[model samples]
Target: MGMAVVTLVLAIPLLAALGLVLVPGYRTPARLNIAASAATFLASLTLFVVEPAATKWFVLDAFNIYLIALTAFVGLTTSLFSAGYIAHEIRIGKLKPLQLRFYHAMYQAFLFTMLLALSANNLGVMWVAVEGATLTTVLMVSLYRTAAGIEAAWKYFILCGVGIALALFGTILMYMAAQPVMGPGMAAMTWTELMVRMPEVNPKVLNLAFVFLLIGYGTKVGLAPLHAWLPDAHAEGPTPISAVLSGLLLNVAIYAVLRFKMLLAANGAAIAPGPLMVAMGLGSLLLAGFMLYRRRDIKRFFAYSSIEHMGIITFAFGMGGPLANFAGLLHMAMHSLTKSAIFYAVGHATQIKGTQRMDAIRGLTVSHPALGWGLLAGVVAIAGLPPFGIFMSEFLLVTSTFARQPLLALPLAAGILIAFGALVLRVQQICFGAPDGVSKAVPVAWSLLPLYAHLGLVLVAGVWIPGPLVAWFQTVAALLG
Candidate 1:
């Protein structure tokens, strides 16, 4: 049953991707995409019920099981949102019928790569999976074939190409670091084996390997300075892709970083990775905060917001304690849900208004109350407002930092406040003002359902968390240390 579940989890997406490309038309492929995503999500849930499974290619544990569940859930919701979104695009001639076949195929392929990366037991295979994710998303980003879209895709491809190459070098370095201890076999490249034997590995070489690995995966995580590709990719890609990129793909890179961080922790002589991660996280937070102030495009503005939230999550993990790590994990889940929900609302709003520019879209509440209010609720949650899941996570992070690293807490709080101002300002302009006379199509019940479902979960999380989930996060937090 263990093997069957894992196999089914992967096989569904792989088979669906191939079949989707051959299947013609819009509705059937969209339904298939949603169905495949839903089945994969259900399969991933069985990981928690079944015992942990570790084979040559895949491994499932407390560390990854919760994340796999989160990824699968978001992927399912995004597919639900995408089905409606793509149909509208086709109606307006923005996307031809045939392009959607490729789109559906690539979407599944992207999910497969992410799931593979998270579940991988071998270091080399994990790196390959991350690279595969980059390639698949690049094609999707340029699906519209516009000048801006193509440019974003090229930029995404080149920057991430360089980043993945660095990651490959880092993977080699990790294998080299392990080979001496494990003595030249598959064990040297295996994650489970490496963790078991981490203490015997040379700390100096491990230190060097970690630096390269951090930079390589950090770029994909959208850390500042290396985040050049993120905003462009988010702004120009199909909204469904943007939704998953934040909700799912970035977490894959974060998962990679945590995997290596575990190795570093197991070695007593290795340099502390916490301070370095904290520095990068702090830098990304402040940089994104100020950048949000100058943003004109709504999606780009929120893209920076994603960076800021990633920075916050990184900072919490970097603090390295049971409380901080727990907060980081919670924030990771919260941000994924809240941000993706925002993108869904944004996708529909932009469709009604016919533009992504902030100035061009106004009076949404007055004109389209459902979308306007939905977008408002999403932005509020994302901006770390009270009575929402994100606020709880951010509060925990801030308090944890104040107790352990008070000096760092000041800037972190400031960055959050700065972003809050910008988001509130921008959302107010779009939701409350006079209507732009361009809206023709109203979003159907299915589109809004997924958006509200996500936000609803987040809201519930703020006030009450399930007992089992709290226990699960606590277990993983210990493992992180």
Candidate 2:
């Protein structure tokens, strides 16, 4: 049953991507996409009940199991959101049916790659999976074929291409680090074996490999100085894709880094990866917060928010303690839910306003109360306001930092405040005041279900975390050290 569940989780998407290529037209493909995503998500849930069938090529444990479920859940919700989003695009001729066929295929391919990356036991296979994820997203980002879209896709390709190259060198170095101790071959490259044997591996090679790994995966995480590709990709690509990029892809990259971090933690001689990660995380947070005040495109604006939050998550994990790591895990989940919900709202708003420009998108509350208020709620939650999951996570992170590293807490607090003010200021301009452009009523209430569902979960999580889940997170945190 365990093997069956895992096979189902992977096979559904791979088969669906193939079947979708032949299943033409708007309605059927959209339904098929949702159905496939739903099946995969259901299979992912079974991972908790069924024993994970860990093998040489694949691994499932306390960590990746949670992420696999997350990836599938978000994939399902995004597909649900995509049904209406893509239909609207087709109605307006922004996308052709042919393009959507390719888009759906690539979407499944992206999911398959992400799941593969999370589940892989082998370092080389994980690298290939991550690279595959980049390729699939690049094709989708260029779906419109417009010059700007193509430019964004190419820019994404080239920048992340460099990142992947650095990562490959790092993976080789990791293998080199393990070869002498483990005596080479697949056992040396496997994550489970490496974890069992890592303390014996040389620390210098581990430190050197991590530098390349951090920057390489860090590019995908949208950490500043390496985040050029993010905003453009979000602004030019379809909104559903933007949601997954922020919600799932960034999490996947960080997941990769965390895996490597664990190996480093095992060796006493490896440089403390904490300071370098902390520096990168803080820099990204500050850069994104200030940049938010300048964005004209709504998607780009939220894209910057993603960078800011990723910084916080990275910082929390870099702090390296039980409390901080737990906070980081919570923030990653909250940010994924909140940011994706915001993109979903932004997608709807742009469709109603006939533009993505903030100036042209005023009075959303007056024009479309559901969307306007939904956007406002998402922004509040994301900005770390009270009674939402983000508030709890950020508060824990800030308090933990203050308790241990007082000076670092000040910069983190400043970054949060800077971003908070920018979000509140901007959301008011967009949601209130007089109506701006086109104000046609959204015909479907069903489309807002994912938005409400996500925000509600975030709300529930703020005040209470179930005990079993808390135990699970605590276990993962201790494992990180």
Candidate 3:
């Protein structure tokens, strides 16, 4: 019964998405999409109330339960944001009703993909789910059919497609690697079964599998060198889509990578996954830190920030102590909330300004004070400033890193400082000083509510995590090892 409910929770959005495309009325589809997403979130809430257990093709455990809840929660909020955002796009002639229909359908499909990736008990199923998300977003990214939008969508499709293909190869290699020990059957490929039998798997096969999987899923995670598709996708897609890309999609991708890392760890003789992840994590941090100073598009700027924080989280896991792992988990949750909140504000700002060019956008404080300040607060929080959950999590990551590897601390600190300065400079230009042009006011009621809710949650978590949640995180972090 539990497995059936969980499967239904994951599948509802995909079914709704198909209905959204086939159904005629716009308002009805929009309402249905929002209601479906909200119900999905409510169903995921059962994770906290229900005990941990495995069902035939799925498992409910500490490691994934919170992420399931978080993904569903963010999916609901983004659906609400999309409702308003697409409506505004139609109102302004930026998008036609036909495109809005595509947008609505694609949005639900994207949610369904992420949910599947999170809940899958088989590694191959998880990879397939991640690939499914990549395909859905390609359509959404190109919904505008503008030159830039089309180009961005193509780039996203090509890169992520190739990356996911590599990940699939890695998955196959893992299966092959496990077959000798666990025997060639479905039993050899199940994540839980593999974890239990991993110690007996060949070390050489595990090492090679890790290398391929890292570069493959790492692309989806937006790690550097593999990250070229991210900025264009963010710059051209609907802002609500950008919100989910940074907030939810990237987290889902990282989750895929972590699952593989767990498999590698279980094979005791395999080369430690820590050093490779650490190197990639540090490399992404340094690259994104330098790249931050040069972004002209606001969304692109934050996309790089997503890369930077993912690096930090990757680094935390790479460090591999209980404290670092705990901090990594917290950072992932905090980054998803804070980054998505920022994108929410950015979406509204771009809409009001009628352009994404940084220079064309100025004096957001005068134009849309609610959105302007919300972006500013989100910026402050994401830059690892105090009173935000990111700051506390980042502080813990750095402290843990310093204790173990003091020399690497300088570059880490430098990256944080550089990102901080760049974010403040661009944000100040947009939010304050002089009015850029004629100002337009959006309804403060709907747009600002989700932004503030996310920010307030990050803030509260920074000050203190409730006992139940903290305990939950600690348990999950232990499992990460």
Winning candidate number (lDDT): 2
Model 2 pairs whose backbones collide:
none
- TM-score of decoy 1: 0.99
Question: After superposition on all CA atoms, how large is the RMSD of candidate 2?
Answer: 1.1
Give candidate 1 regions above 4 Å deviation: none
lDDT of 2 at 115: 93
CA-lDDT, candidates in order: 0.91, 0.92, 0.87
Candidate 2 lDDT by residue in tens digits, 288-399: 9999999999999999999999999999999989999999999989999999999999999998887889989999999899988999999999999989999999999999
List runs of model 3 lying over 4 Å from the truth: none
Residue 417 of model 1: what lDDT?
Answer: 95
Q: How far off is residue 205 in model 3, in Å?
A: 0.7
Candidate number that wins on lDDT, 1 or 2: 2
Misplaced by over 4 Å in model 2 are: 51-53, 441-443
lDDT string, candidate 3, 1-481, tens digits: 5676677788788788888888764677778888999989998887677777775468778878899899999888887877778778878888887766566778888899898898888887888899999998998888789999999999999999989999999999999999998888888779999999999999998898889999999999999889999989988888989999999999999899999898888888999999888888888888998898899988899999999998888888888878999999999999999998998888888888888888888988777778878888899999899989999998998888789899887788788788888888888898888877785647547857788989999999989899999898899888988
Alpha-carbon deviation at 284 in model 2, angstroms: 0.3
Task: Give the Cα error of residue 148 in candidate 2, in Å.
Answer: 1.3
- Give the Cα error of residue 333 in candidate 3, in Å: 0.7
